[model samples]
Target: MEENLSGQLADAVAQGADEADLARARAGDEAAFTRLVEPLRRELHAHCYRMLGSAHDADDALQDALLRAWRGLARFEGRSAVRTWLYTVATRTSLDIVEARGRRALPADLGPSSDRAVLDGNAPLTDVAWLAPYPDAGLAGDPAGPDARYEQREAVELAFVAALQHLPGNQRAALLLFEVLGFSAAEIATMMATSTTSVNSALARARKIVAHRVPPRTQQRTLRRIGDARVREIATRFATSLERGDADALVALLTEDVTWSMPPLPNWYRGIEAVTDFAVQVPMTRCPSWRHRVTSANGQPTVAFYLGDDAAGPHAAWSITVLTLRGEHIAEITSFLGPDGFAPFGLPASLP
Candidate 1:
C-alpha cells in the first residue's frame, strides 16, 4: 500500500514538472520544449515508421511533426498529455506523406515469382518506393499502453510493416493508433479528425487485410522459441555458405518452401528449388567473393554482405539479408540490397 502511494506521488511530481516545462515551451523556450519531447521521441519515431513503412520517411515525418508541434505549442490546451499531442501531430504528418508519396513495395508484391534465376537485365526499379528495413537497435519491448496489442518490436517486423503498405492512409493510421498504440476509437477519431464509427470501420478493414498477409505467429515469438544461440548459428552458417559458394550447405539451412527476394529488383524466388537456382547462378558462381557481418533487422537474424572481386581489396556494401525463420528452418530471405540500408544499421559502406 505504501509503495503504491509512493508511485502515485512520483507520478504527481513528474506531472507537475511537465506542466512547468509545458508552460515554458509554450512561451518559446526551446530548451524546455526539447526536455518535454526527448523522452517520447523514440517511440514516436517508431510509430511514424509503422505508419509510413520506411525509416527515412519516418525521420522526415517526425522532424516535420516536431516542428509543427513547436510552432503550435501555444495552442495546446493541455487537455491531453504531451505524448498524445505529439502522436497526433506525427500521425497526421505521416498520413500527408503517405498520400503524397504512396505506399512502398517489395519484390514479392510486384508479380509472380520466377522459377529460375533472373540473370539478364535484372536492374533495380528506381521508380518504385521500396519497403526499407527498420534498424531495431535500442527499440523498446513494451506496448504503448495496457490496451496495446503489439509489443514495440513486434510491430516493426518486416512482414507487419509490409502488410501495412496495403492499407490506405486513414485505415493505416486508425489501425495503428487503435491496436498498436492502444488509443480508444473515440481518441483515434479525435487524433485523425474523423468519427468513431469511421475509425471502427477502418480498423475492421485494416485488420482483415493484415490478417491475410502477416503470418499468425510473429518473428519475435519464433526467435524466442528458437533461442539466440541457435539463431546466430543459422545466420552465420547461411552467410558462410554464400562466402564459400557452398550451395548444398546453404540448401540445408532453408525450408523446402523458402522464399528469396531482393527489393527493387521486381523478382522473387519461392520454394527451395527456385531459390537454389538463383543462389547458385548469382551469388555463388557469378559474384566473386563475399564477407559478412551478422546483424538483426526487423527483429529477425540478418547478415550484412560485402562483395568484391579482389581478395586484397575492400568489399563494397551489398545487401542486408533478413532471415525469417519457421521453427528451425529459414523460411524467408529478404535481402534489402544497396548501401542505403547500411547507414541506419551503422554499418560501414565497405570492409577490407
Candidate 2:
C-alpha cells in the first residue's frame, strides 16, 4: 500500500512535494500523476458510492475522476486542494449520471413495506435501487468526531439515499456537499455555478423532504436492534445451510412471501418455494461442489462464492448476495454479479 501510494503523483500531494512534480506531470509524467492520486483511492471510492448509489458506478466514476484528474493536473492551479478538486470532479460526474438517468427509486418508495421495519420511515421504493447502506466500518475516524458527523446511519441507508434521489440532481449535490461533506454554501454555489441562496433553498427543501421520509428515532432504534440481531443470525445460518446444501434449512430461513432477484438476470422469483427451487434445483445442482466464504455487502452479510480450483483468478467473481432479515429468517435475497457489485460493502475479491 505504501509503495502504491508513494509514486510520482504521490510526490505531488506529499506534504512538501516539489511543485516540480505537477510541472512534470503537466509535461506528461504518468508516474507522477498516479502517485499524486493513489492515496485517495478508498475515500474517493466511498464518495463515489455515496453520490452514485451503486459501487459499480462509484468505481467507474472514481476511475474516470482519476483519469480526468491526471489529464487536468497541470491546470488544477492549486485552486483547491487536489483532494477537494477531485471531489468536485467526482460529485459533478456523479450528478451528471444521476441527472441523465433521472435518478432511480422503486415501488417500495411509492408505498410502505416490511422494509420499513428496518428503517425509521415509510417503505423503500422497490423500483428504485436506492443508495446501498455503507457499513459504519467503512468509515475510518473518530466515529463520534465531527469529521464523521453526517447522520451515519441515515446518510448511507437505502431509504434516505432514495429520498435524496427525489430532489433535483443539483439539490442532491448541494445536500451532499453541505451536509455530508461539510462544504459551505458559498463553496457549493461555486461548484454548481449558483448563488448561495439557491444552495440554501435546495438544502432546506431537501431536509424537509428527508424528515418526512426518514423513520423516527424511537422506531428506527427498536427496529435496528431487532433487525441487526436477526440479520447476523440469519446470515450465519444461511451461509451454513448453503455450505451443507441443506435444502430444508435454506427454505426455512426465507419468509413465506419472500422475494429474490438477481440483477442483470432479468427474472424475479417470488415466495419461498420459488426461491428454493431456483437455488437448489437450478444453480446449486449444476455447481454441486461449490464453496462459499462470508463477507459483508450493502451493510448486510454477504456470501462470496467460487467453484473449483480455478476460481481465485481474475473475472472469477461469482454472485454477490445481499440479504434482508426479519426475525430469525431472511425475507429477501438479491444476488448481484455485476463486476463492481462486490465493492463498497468491502467484500473481498476472493474468499480465504
The per-model lDDT (C-alpha) reads 0.92, 0.63
**Candidate 1 structure quality by residue, lDDT tens digits, 1-352:** 9999999999999999999999999888999999999888888888999988888998999999999999999889988889889999999999999999999999888999999999997888999999988888737633477688987778989999999999999999998988888999999999988899999999999999999999999999999998999999999999999989899999999999999999879889999999999999999999998999999888899999999986678899999999999998999999999988899999999998
Name the regions of candidate 2 deviating beyond 4 angstroms.
1-14, 18-28, 105-148, 151-154, 160-163, 211-233, 242-261, 264-291, 305-318, 324-332, 337-352
Best by TM-score: 1
- Global Cα RMSD, each model: 1.2, 8.6
lDDT of 2 by residue, 210-272 (tens): 778754442234347776566566777786776567888888888897876554444556777
Q: Assess every candidate by TM-score.
A: 0.97, 0.64
* Candidate 2 Cα RMSD after full superposition onto the native fold (Å): 8.6
Query: Which candidate ranks first by lDDT, i.e. highest?
Result: 1
Q: Model 1, stretches more than 4 Å misplaced?
A: 141-143
For model 2, the run of ten residues with the poorest summed lDDT: 115-124
Lowest-lDDT window of 10 residues in candidate 1? Answer: 137-146
What's the residue-level lDDT of 170 in candidate 1?
97
